[model samples]
Target chain A: MRLRNGPAASVRYEGILRICAIGLAVFSLLSWLLLGANRGWTKTTRTRWQKDPVTEIEGPLIEKAFLPGVDLLAVGLSGALILFVVSLLVTKNKTNSNQVNSSS
Target chain B: MKNKFVAALGFIALAATAFAAPLEFDFKDPKGVNNVIFKTDAPLESINGTATGISGNVTFDPDNPGAVKGKIVVQSASLHLGNPMQKEHLHSDKWLDVTRYPEITFEVESAKNVKTEGNVTTADVGGKMSLHGATKPITVPVKMTFLKDKLKARTGKEGDLLVIRANFKIRRSDFRINPGQMEDKVSDDIELNLSIAGAAPRG
Candidate 1:
């Protein structure tokens, strides 16, 4: 009795990867929301520029607004999500190949 | 009548001859000026850089020993780390917040001359360091060389910039930056280095 490389295995892998991707996306989004709700970024930008020529020219320059930790988390989670999606696609392709081979 | 007239004339002449002296700096030609460098070390990496803004007067009179005082303010936000991500993190809200508190100011509290070693004049300078909206007292050991029309004081330099250098750690949490998810990723202790140069007055 041969173990089948069929729809069952593909479905399981797909489900797992989807769950992982969703979890990471949710975590990243939640962090962004929580950070905003806490007004953490607000503290850094509270100072207003006076109407001075130097400030007028430089004030519009946008600096890094995300906290280091949050930025890291967001990047890390984004990478993981991308990898998982890629892996899911690869697994689906492999499963299709196996199905074709069995039919032939 | 002739003697009384001469006495009044002599007193007036002596008073008129007195002249106000110009500001004289003992170290007229500072070996170096406007050269100060600060560095930080971390487990993952180390960051080191020099500051461009330095202005102050140093009047050292051995006999009279007049007070020597000055102020140094480094644009905290201008500090550059090798990594752009790290630099951004440093200036972000979780760290230095360079936008809101753009400058790291250090005002000389006191400069006491230590034992003279050859031409080098070592002074312990006490001052307040304001960073991240918090001010803390810091003492910097400064070795100054009096050059013609310049005063060169250095903290750390090895083929990079100067000689005078200091190493101290500052906890980000102490300045009200608490550790949390993203904040916890970075080390609390940060190292600082100060290298400075100033124009020496001409005789």
Candidate 2:
């Protein structure tokens, strides 16, 4: 049997790509927010600033720092962009193929 | 008159001897509260890390602040960034080379412009700092507070506490750290802030 290569197949591919793009974007946002939405680079450790009452010195002590930072956002956004671009290419290829078939 | 002058001179000599005696402060804090923060800010990227593996001894005379002498050493491998990958890179051969040079040290040779107010003594400490593989003479402005018999409050031990604070800047290239490369990502100037409390327990 021949594989489907028309409007139906194109629509299916577009739907899958759109879903993947949305999923990646959502994942990135959720992960970034969960990881404290750090504006700087990704950090594996988090710190809590504390002051020693006796010495009166303030410093950061490591808290639960195993959290990702803006790097997660970058990765997720980049993945979404690639998927969106692929979807556009798929639509263009389907239109071209249909045009060629009709001309024959 | 001569006997009176000789007795006065002897009293002055005794007072000077008492002032010259230094208290040795051991900086190997078991509480893990001591830390040195190192920061690099470049046009493209800024990095911050902390080193907690600090140990050394400093001979500080509160009565004679200008005669201070000591060595402070930080473990190279103890330097850590928030990012694990970046931390690994920092400890790698191309960066700090932690395996080759395990200790970053600053040995104090002299102090200048020493000033004392209350329990705090501030001075420009001249020291030879050995980092990466090169040793450079650097002068760091240090403020030290000698808390007499206050170690019990922090560690539940009867001792004296010496709180030291210093802020200094160093050129990474001077220490041969990736000289002339990745300047956009890693700044050549490394800003360091050291805050440590040394305990000298009395018998």
Candidate 3:
């Protein structure tokens, strides 16, 4: 079976990959901005409690410091980075393949 | 007539001495267990935080729970969020402005509908809540538990302990906290939960 190794096909494929990568990155950036751009780990739980040793009283000791949408930012950015790297690799392969084919 | 008046005064003084005075429980817990949790839920976001710098005094009389009175003060700076940027914004002028208002205070004026069961007493507490440079009258449902001679067990000091728990809601607009702003991300109604244990150590 023959593969689609034409220059135009390769170029079109690379363009699609690049466009998808950029879209992912833009979406991640916008989501992060909207979520307040948390610099720490994301959390969703509403409340936490700590028990006092002396008083033996349990009360809300911590609250959700990271907002709800922060996790979305983290996941989105990570996915965008992966896609961007994949796109870069795809473009590099296409260039290498074209150079070899022209030389042959 | 003079002799009778002297005798009456003596009797009155003896009676007063026999009546126990209300115990002043100090809410400044060295154990750092006293805390106030606040939450506000909106369509776009839910904001929650905890304040641990609590200090105040409440005069509680086990025999008369309805007569409870005191003040609770929370340091405005102690209101904390998990995110540093969000925490800073909360304390900024756009929100609480902690520098301008150094403290959030509640002065208990009266208690009503008090009912005592075992060591716990429940009541409707009326007080003046001062927050964000505004003071407003509010009523909250409070549950107080009097632990006689329990201070020694908790703090290794011979004393009595009073545990107080309350759940209430307040309107941020009432305190002029960025009124009519951020209603979508931050709700106007703020729910507060208070838990504290006050100790009155004895010699």
Candidate 4:
């Protein structure tokens, strides 16, 4: 092609996929950690049990953006991770198939 | 003399039965409400909000105010401040961190120095209260209405209704709500007052 100093085209595509996977991993982890407890609250002192209903507390942006219904978000992240792994497997399978074909 | 002793024993047994009878009810009345009010520094106005999702019970004897005991639990996530930004900070990690802790509970283990005047009775209700994350034992001065006739008329039922109110101050630092400079804007000593509308069958 007419590329000046850029890396090979296939290498660029692989790099993009790697970056995407890393980003999704971070997003998924942060969302899971931030979800914390879905509901319920208790106030306690040094000596007693104070069990009560779940009162609405102000949640942070991380919580507001990713929690409560975060199970869906987690599922989406897992799907993306699975796709990444699948792609890797397909690439490996194709390489093996090509090697066998060449040998034949 | 033997007859007199038997009569004395019968009277003592009757008193024990009266003293042991328990009055119990839930805070499930739709019309019932719980509210908490707190004041900030001079520049900031005091804040008040309605407490929802409240459910608890009280069990005690009118014949003996000192034997009264119960516990109530309030959900932390239900705290609502009309303003958006203020609510955010108040529940953040620096303040309440409601995400970390979801409920605030208070249990009455005992009562002491019980005294009554007219329909209003006062007692040193000793209990363990848990807020934020720390649990502490404190003796709260409680005032309650102990009149069966008045409560019976109000509830439109023959059951007993008791109205209890307790006021106390707690140090925020003790629970790690906000420490250091944050304490300046919001006082370390946060005032908490609880007024409970509880009821049960007459003993």
Best by lDDT: 2
DockQ of every candidate: 0.03, 0.54, 0.24, 0.01
| CA deviation > 4 Å runs, candidate 3 | A1-48, A53-56, A59-104, B1-19
TM-score of chain A of each: 0.49, 0.81, 0.58, 0.43
Error of 3 at B63 (Å): 0.5
Tens digits of per-residue lDDT, candidate 1, B1-203, equal 89989998987876654432223332111232333344545455445444443434444433222244545566766665434555688779767787888777666667665645544567776777777788888777766543322222222221111123234566666676654324334556665654443332332
Q: Provide the TM-score for each candidate, comma-separated.
A: 0.48, 0.89, 0.73, 0.56
Model 2, residue A21: C-alpha shift (Å): 1.1
The prediction achieving the highest TM-score against the true structure is 2
CA lDDT scores, all candidates in order? 0.51, 0.89, 0.84, 0.61
After the best TM-score superposition of candidate 3, give how far the Cα of residue B173 lies from its true spot, in angstroms. 0.1
Q: Against the true structure, candidate 4 has what lDDT?
A: 0.61
Q: Which candidate is the best by DockQ?
A: 2
In Å, residue B121's CA in model 4 sits off its true spot by 1.2
What lDDT tens digits, residue by residue, belong to model 4 across residues B91-180? 787677788887777899998888878767898888887879989888888888764644455455566667677777777767767655
- In the range A1-104, model 3's lDDT, one tens digit per residue, is 11267666666766786788788778878766766665443544345677866455776655444453556676777887777777666677777778978999
Give TM-score, chain B, model 3.
0.91
Off by over 4 Å in 2: A1-5, A97-104, B1-20
Show where candidate 4 strays beyond 4 Å.
A1-104, B1-20, B42-46, B149-157, B201-203
Candidate 2 per-residue lDDT over residues A8-54, each given as its tens digit: 78878988998999999898999889767888888868866677878
Looking at model 4 chain B, report the run of 10 residues with the lowest lDDT sum. Answer: B41-50
Candidate 3, clashing residue pairs?
A: A65-B82
Report, for all candidates in order, the number of backbone clashes.
24, 3, 1, 28
What tier of docking accuracy does candidate 1 attain?
Answer: incorrect
